[model samples]
Target: MHVQNKKRFYLMVGLLIVVILLVGFSIYMIWSDISSSNAPVQTASNTTNTANADSSQGNRTDITASQAITNPTDLLVLVNKTTSLDENYQPSDLVWVDLPGVRETQLRKEAATALEDLFAAAELKNLSLYCCSGYRSYQTQEELYAENVKTYGQKEADLVSAKPGQSEHQTGLAMDVTAESVNFDLLESFGQTTEGEFIKNNAHLYGFIIRYPEDKTAITGYAYEPWHLRYVGKDVAAEIDKNNLTFEEYLKTS
Candidate 1:
């Protein structure tokens, strides 16, 4: 019948319209995803955006984690969120430290000697810098990270604690120092005290530099840890201090 055929024609047209709409939607979704994938990813840090400076070009550098250090024992080896030491790479020249109330008191022999000189120099200046921590193992760092994750959520814990193999303490060339002025605590307030000032000004003379400076969190990938000192030999330390450069910057030029 003509009327029956007319109804069937309308039904087919409606189904065809629905099919076209679904096909168009699928194409739009695929195109949107492809465009999004081409966009540059922003590396957001907890405190601020990690800056990638290129003074020569006077523009933001393309920041990326450099290749892992070939020799972890290199005196000036750089380690950070980007640069990581191997889990099995422990320093061969570690020596026990007898500093007061310090845990994990072992450092490379050369660094240990420099630390003693630094502490002695502080004492002569009537400032007491107490070494708190040094030389963490991969397992120890893993435990620390898990504990932090429990206390704070994973996002917060990532900001506060380094993941295993990502900590500089594993290198035996970094030390955390505190003073009685801050109740022997590793507090940012320590950086403002006379003792912290002495270390800040005098540490490079003893082959060490403040690993994280107050203004360098964007470059250092962590909050300012004024108590953390990394030994890179006095010449390199002095250069880093004089230029006001982060270890990341120093590595690029050095």
Candidate 2:
């Protein structure tokens, strides 16, 4: 009887220990789940996090050099002397631009459509506009940059041409426009022509912006490229126009 009682006591103690362990484990699991639930979620749609909104707010004109853009495919992706696209980055939706151009080229489908609308609008005004350049691959930009360096020297080339990955052409959202007034050349003189004036006044109406305005050279880190138009969508373009802001400034304030 004594041995049996000892055995029963041992069994009861073992059962209690097991119950305690199970309860502790359940509590730990519940705590772990709660902690997981309270943790912040990260997603690609979080543009504010990726765009470095704080840096933009602090130094609207200052761009961090060699900053890799997190949102490469976004229409608002900032590419300049400070920000660079990946060497391998290419727009997946590039389509051959079916428009009057100096040479055959391509643009992102959405940009291409906007360009068509812009050109059509210009035609209505009897302004004969031409597309001088559109999308350029990284390799093409590299070659162009090298040629510019060879032809014009490094200093002038730096002002005129973007280092390969830094070119907005790679985004397939920029187009260099020209007219007979400039003889189909991408020149600053284009800004003075009637065609140029029309573009400056009406481009934003069709979701494009004269990316490098004559007055914003210091902020843009480039020469006043009046021929260069960047697609930022109609609403953004209107806001930029109304505020007379460069893309960098618009993004900073936004």
Candidate 3:
């Protein structure tokens, strides 16, 4: 009887040890799971990246976020990534463009007249230039920018598209031009076509300038858009072209 009791006590001790081991393992597993659950999970869409000016573009002006632009109606008003026009701002003199285009668009009366002359001059040279886009509203720009972000991701979209209220098109002075040689699409290769070269050389004669030049992408915060023209009046446009300055640079020194 004594031997049997001792045997039972030993068995109980072993079973208790096993139970304690199992409990400890479960506690450790729970703690590990809790730690993993608390950790951060980074995703492509959630990652934040602040945009910095390209060093090659020269020292970028540190603009206050959502800075108010008071000269929204000025022909040379500056709009960019930092500065923004009012969401409700629309040009009072907006007029439908009579020039050939991919879609119906409008620009300020003065800019519309300038664009007409530019197109007519191109026609004289047998260089068929078509308006791709012009005079975007804040809402339209928002939707367009959202679409771009969905398609290209935020980082890439920022490089190619402007946020709402930050676009120059909102001022009714900017136009995106294209040609049949490139299927009437906005493309960098359009800069190499005959129409592109003609516009680059002579657009200023009609009160426009290649707003974003090939070599000034850094300063402009945009890619080389030879097709994008901004009407800044004949004198300002001529000075900008002659000095080989982007509109941003011209504004700084002027």
Candidate 4:
């Protein structure tokens, strides 16, 4: 009887030892799995932060060059010196007749010449283009703003016209072109026309670009104006056109 009791006690001890070993192994495996699951999340967070830092570093590198001026105030001066546009928002008073007999004034001689070259290159075909607006003086801009406010109210007018000195037209680097058939109305439908497409594809060759492209309204501070072209000169315009960038982006890169 004593031998049988001892045997039973030994059997119970063996069973308890086996259960403890199984429980410990299970706990260890669970801990390892949890640790493994967290590794990918940690790696992803590190990668995201690293990518943002690299992008910021690249932007800083672009600005570090002596010739590359990124600040709008400094860039305005650089662009004015580099191009034919008037400095300090002064526009030329000379008005020239364009291809379709539209009398238009340009801010500079270079702007007129560039337009003439572009017009000559255009096939025209059945399409006739007219220059509606070119340069604007401080007074002219104020008058336009007043008129817009009367017609569209203050808020709406502000969107369509710049506040006097802030306008690109005041610098004489920009122009407004339109289809003669449409009476120079700026519209997206014009972009679908062959003449529009031609201008879109070839304007960069003559140192011009569509100032407010459809995709870049947020950056340009204006709605899409297919007719508005800004002259930054051939080299810069070509780069902007080729890279599919806004003047703001081009300014940053410069």
Candidate 5:
């Protein structure tokens, strides 16, 4: 009888040890899963998070300098001094800009439609906006850069003209706008004109932005070019305008 009791006690103790081990393992697994779930939700792939309502209140990761963009077809492609499009990158949906008697330039289909609306709205308010240039191919930009070098010398040219693959024009997402107020010339002075003021105030409503603003030369690595307009979609444009952020800054924060 004593031997049987001792045997039963040992069996009970073994079963209790097994239960305790099982519970401890389950707690450890649950803790591990919770830690993983609470990790960062940001990704380098999305480039920037959408400008949420609480845009001012988040732990936004800065957009680091990256190589060529992986997806050129994405509407919000970041092409600037640091990032270059490949020699062969081209918009598949290029369409002629439909503003009356404007330059024979083309923009991406969605951009073209938004540009037409922008122009029409400007006309309604007695402002005359002109499209001076758009969508320069890699070869065209190379030739233009050479011409600029001859006219302005290399140092001056580099400030205004982009090297072949580094131009926003290559993305088919930008246009050089002008007005008779500035004699259809792309000049920094244009930003001071009444027509320019209209554009600066309203371009965001139409999905356009004054790509390079004055005093932002340090960030953009280019001189101020108020004439250059880039399409980044209305919501993005509005957020950029509202926050007084360069697209680079916007990408970094939001």
Candidate 6:
């Protein structure tokens, strides 16, 4: 009877040890699974923080597409204005003939003064920048269009010159500038000379922008014209330049 009781006690002891071991293994497995799940979350959070820091450090300017144009009214002015032949078309017309003045007509008086300053600056370097075309009239635009169609065919002429009433030149805020030897021939000399590059790069400082840049041909509906500068004020020009957007793209976002 004593041996049987001892045997029974030993059996109970072994079962208790086995149950404890199983409980311990289950606890360890649950802990390990929880730790593994938490590790990925921690890594993901660190990666996100690093990416945000890197983006902030890389760019000082707010160059998002929405920041390109601040004024919505400016776009309305550009689209509502009529273009003239003398200002943007071939066989230039007289400056004061049109009822609605060209973009130069409405430009801040300071703009003209700035042109004078620009000329003076250019003179120092023996680089002559002259305004070949400033403002144009609707009648002048019509005549120019007729002539273009006669000379270059409708399709070819349309590529270079806008039809009457559809031009940006009528705003009196645009100008066609040319170097001394290449006067009025801005179309042929874009990106070829130092003067062209200078105007293209620095025109924004004076509240002017290349109306039709090379990369934005599709948007502007015209080929690149390095010498054509549109005045939209200094702040707007700076934003446009920084964002690298065409006027059309700026309009869409704004």
lDDT of 6 by residue, 145-253 (tens): 7898999998888767767755665545566777655643756575567778777677778777778887676777777778777766666677778899776665566
- Model 5: per-residue Cα lDDT over 1-254, one tens digit each: 35668878999999999999999999999999999999988776554443342242212223232311545655566787778889988888899987753468999988889899999998999888899998999989989999999999999998898988889998898999999988888899999998889889999999998888889978887899988999888888899899998978877776
Q: Show the lowest summed lDDT stretch of 10 residues, model 3.
A: 50-59
lDDT of every model, 2 decimals: 0.81, 0.87, 0.84, 0.68, 0.82, 0.60
Tens-digit per-residue lDDT, 51-130, candidate 2 = 67633432232233223256677777799998888889998889999999889989999899999999999999988888
Select the stronger candidate by lDDT from 4 and 6. 4
TM-scores of all candidate predictions against the true structure? 0.72, 0.74, 0.73, 0.62, 0.73, 0.58
lDDT score for candidate 4 against the true structure: 0.68
Q: Best candidate per lDDT, number?
A: 2
Quote the lDDT for 165 in model 2.
97
Over the stretch 118-231, how does candidate 1's per-residue lDDT look in tens digits?
A: 898887987777889899999999999999999999887776689999999999999999887898888888889998899889999998999989888778878888899998
Q: Write the per-residue lDDT of candidate 3 for residues 1-254, one digit (tens) a residue.
A: 35658878999999999999999999999999999999997665533332232211111223322221445766767888878889999988899999889999999998999899988988888888899899999999999999999999998898789999999999999999999999999999999999999999999999898988997767888878888898888888898889998877777676
Clashing pairs in 4: none
Q: For model 1, state the Cα shift of residue 159 in Å.
A: 2.5
Pairs with backbone N, CA or C atoms under 3 Å apart (clashes), candidate 3: none
Clashing residue pairs found in predicted model 5: none
Candidate 1: list runs displaced more than 4 Å. Answer: 1-68
Pick the TM-score winner. Answer: 2
CA deviation > 4 Å runs, candidate 4: 1-89, 92-101, 124-126
Q: How far off is residue 188 in model 3, in Å?
A: 0.3
lDDT of 3: 0.84
Give each model's clash number: 0, 0, 0, 0, 0, 7
